[model samples]
Target: MPDTTLSNCVRDAATQAAGLPRRRSVPVSLIAAVAALGGLLFGYDTGIISAALLFIGDTFALDDTVKQIVTAAIVAGALVGCLAAGP
Candidate 1:
């Protein structure tokens, strides 16, 4: 069997010699705040259209078919955008 304790000691010594910081410099709170802001913006962007569509439909005097088409167009645009940003 391999000498696990010896291997661990060597690994720790190598890491210490490399002069890398063992602790994180950036705060976790800052990372969480940024992530939360992104989520809020994404939620607002996807949800605002539904609320605005009511006023838009009334102002334009749009029928159900046209209103559906407008909503579908927004969804299709989002789908295309997501596809374009694929991993």
Candidate 2:
């Protein structure tokens, strides 16, 4: 029979030679910047829409009920998106 210690050493050496590949990691600063930019854009878009709501109501002669519905639609869309992006 082959020597047990010698066989073990050969297996360990083979494993070392076939070592797992190293993984590349994303930088924290880059991730933080991307997240910040996304937040900025979302806030900007919401603000612009809110500001334009007045003009839209005036141009379309929308009543208070219709205006509320339009605002609710935006909130509903955001809720759906939040739900879809689960943790």
Candidate 3:
């Protein structure tokens, strides 16, 4: 077998020769801003759904149970997506 030390030295030298830059960290303020915007959009979405429920109910003849389900569905889907995408 080849010497481990020599192999590691060559591998490291090859890596350095590739000249790839290290990954940079994101700024806290930018992260916070994006989170805030997401929250705002979510709030607006629920608010619009609530506001339109009356018209939707009239059009679709949805009962109380179904309306409750419709309202909860968005939240449930968001929960599932977040869990699936989590580390």
Candidate 4:
């Protein structure tokens, strides 16, 4: 016969040791909201730049090289910022 009492005792001990209650110290919804806000801002900035580039090019009479440089500058800045922030 299986030892049900031993199995239940082991399971209970494991659950207590895992400290599941501490996990909710910070609300999941708040964490998700902050993450969502960051993503929304990133998307907004990208879209604004994409749309503005057309008008900026037209206004400045930019050549292909200059347009490429402008786009590359934004990407490079983002790369540098990411690197500085660290993993």
lDDT of 2 at 15: 70
lDDT of 3 by residue, 1-87 (tens): 955798677776776789854333579778988999989988998899898899989999999999999999988988898899897
Each candidate: RMSD: 9.3, 13.8, 12.6, 7.9
Model 1, residue 43: distance off in Å is 4.6
lDDT of 2 at 8: 71
Worst 10 residues of 2 by lDDT: 20-29
Ranking by TM-score: 3, 4, 2, 1
| Model 2: per-residue Cα lDDT over 1-87, one tens digit each | 855798676776777788944333569778888889978977887787778789999999999899889878886887799799897
Best lDDT among the predictions, by candidate number: 3
Model 4, total clashes: 0
Q: Which candidate do you rate higher for TM-score, 1 or 4?
A: 4
Runs of candidate 1 with Cα error greater than 4 angstroms are 1-43
Mind giving the per-residue lDDT tens digits that candidate 4 earns over 15-79? Answer: 78996442343588788998899789877877778788899999999987988898788878878
Off by over 4 Å in 3: 1-26
- lDDT of every predicted structure (CA atoms): 0.81, 0.80, 0.85, 0.80
Q: What would the per-residue lDDT of candidate 1 be over residues 9-38, giving only the tens digit for each residue?
A: 787677799986445447787888888997
Clashing pairs in 4: none
For candidate 4, the lDDT comes to 0.80
